[model samples]
Target: MIIESTWHKSSYSRAETNCLEAAYMTTGGAVVRDTQNRSLGYLEFSAMEWSAFLVEVKSCDL
Candidate 1:
């Protein structure tokens, strides 16, 4: 029941210590986490939720 996904870091993250990673789940959702503290786990978001979040981020609304 475990799903595996490839995590990717943002290209804008030039500093190793200050980076976030994201992975797309098999269920069509996504997960995001701090690259520096991966052992802490990640935040899961549904596909719609993830899209809304991306829109807000791009618009600087949050």
Candidate 2:
């Protein structure tokens, strides 16, 4: 897979655990990956999916 060139670390990620990083792609949507092992490939999510995920995250339902 061709990784996006402008990937950025998410501010929500914990400085201690180093879990997730996210970035917007030129084609649209976004990419999400584990900061500790980015080479494993990332999971792509559409804008709607990401928005729903954020809502769930804010709800603390995890």
Candidate 3:
């Protein structure tokens, strides 16, 4: 099967010019890319790894 992803950015950064965009994979993982450099391609993460990364990000103050 073929799946397509829709890239989106955080609502908090909607007014910002520089930010990152992300899309979800059908396999339960995610893909991320820089808004300013789409030509550079993106980074893909496995489902497990993505979940861990999100947990860490939420735990941080940043």
Candidate 4:
């Protein structure tokens, strides 16, 4: 049930099995989901927002 979008694992995740996975939406948005369940609902973020969020995450502020 996995939709193909070139998902890349999160570098910050260190889980043994389940980690974070992300892909691009058709509308140019970002889709983030748990790797453990591809059928689960994903969280979508705008390009600008995703970029800011990443910065926050990288800075350990999130």
Candidate 5:
């Protein structure tokens, strides 16, 4: 199930549009959505998946 959360963007993101917003899930995961079209809904990731994603991102492997 998806949990409601406060959406936020990367600190490095400066553009007002086309950016992605993410929120923490109470169940140790995350939800992501587009900044431009919130009505499109969001994507959820498990904690393990989320951690792997962050590792890839930090290593510029994504």
Candidate 6:
């Protein structure tokens, strides 16, 4: 069964139209996408992968 995700934007995002959105998948993973293009779809990442990505982003290493 395909489950819907609850998408959310970053609290730190500027008061602009363009931003990023993310959602947790029912499959124990997460998905991210651009707020400006919902039709383009999203990128999926495993829980572990998402954690590592968050670490790098916090460190400004991306």
On TM-score, the candidate that comes out on top is 5
* Alpha-carbon deviation at 48 in model 5, angstroms: 0.7
How do these models rank on TM-score, best leading? Answer: 5, 3, 1, 6, 4, 2
Candidate 4, 1-62: lDDT as tens digits: 33347988888677777689888766666889997777887888887888888799889997
Q: Per-model C-alpha lDDT, please?
A: 0.83, 0.79, 0.79, 0.78, 0.84, 0.80
Encode model 6's per-residue lDDT on 1-62: one tens digit a residue: 23366789977666576688888877766898888788999898987898899999999998
Runs of candidate 4 exceeding 4 Å displacement: 1-5, 15-18, 26-28
Q: Tell me which residue pairs clash in candidate 1.
A: none
Ranking by lDDT: 5, 1, 6, 3, 2, 4
Clashes of 1: 0
Summed over model 3, clashes come to: 0
Q: Which of 3 and 6 is the better model by TM-score?
A: 3
lDDT of 6: 0.80
Over all chains combined, what TM-score does candidate 4 have? 0.68
Q: Between 4 and 5, whose TM-score is larger?
A: 5
What's the TM-score of each model vs. the native?
Answer: 0.76, 0.65, 0.77, 0.68, 0.82, 0.71
**Candidate 2 lDDT, 1-62, residue by residue in tens:** 34467777878788778778888765556789999898998899877887788789899986
Give lDDT: candidate 3, residue 19.
Answer: 73
Candidate 2 runs further than 4 Å off: 1-5, 10-18, 26-28
lDDT value, residue 13 of candidate 5: 59
- What is the C-alpha lDDT profile of model 5 across 3-60, one tens digit per residue? 6678889676568656888998888899988877889998999999999999999999
Give the TM-score (vs. native) of candidate 6: 0.71
Which candidate gets the maximum lDDT versus the true structure?
5
Model 3 regions lying over 4 Å from their true place: 1-4, 11-17
lDDT of 1 by residue, 1-62 (tens): 23467899977676745898898877777898898888999899987998899899899988
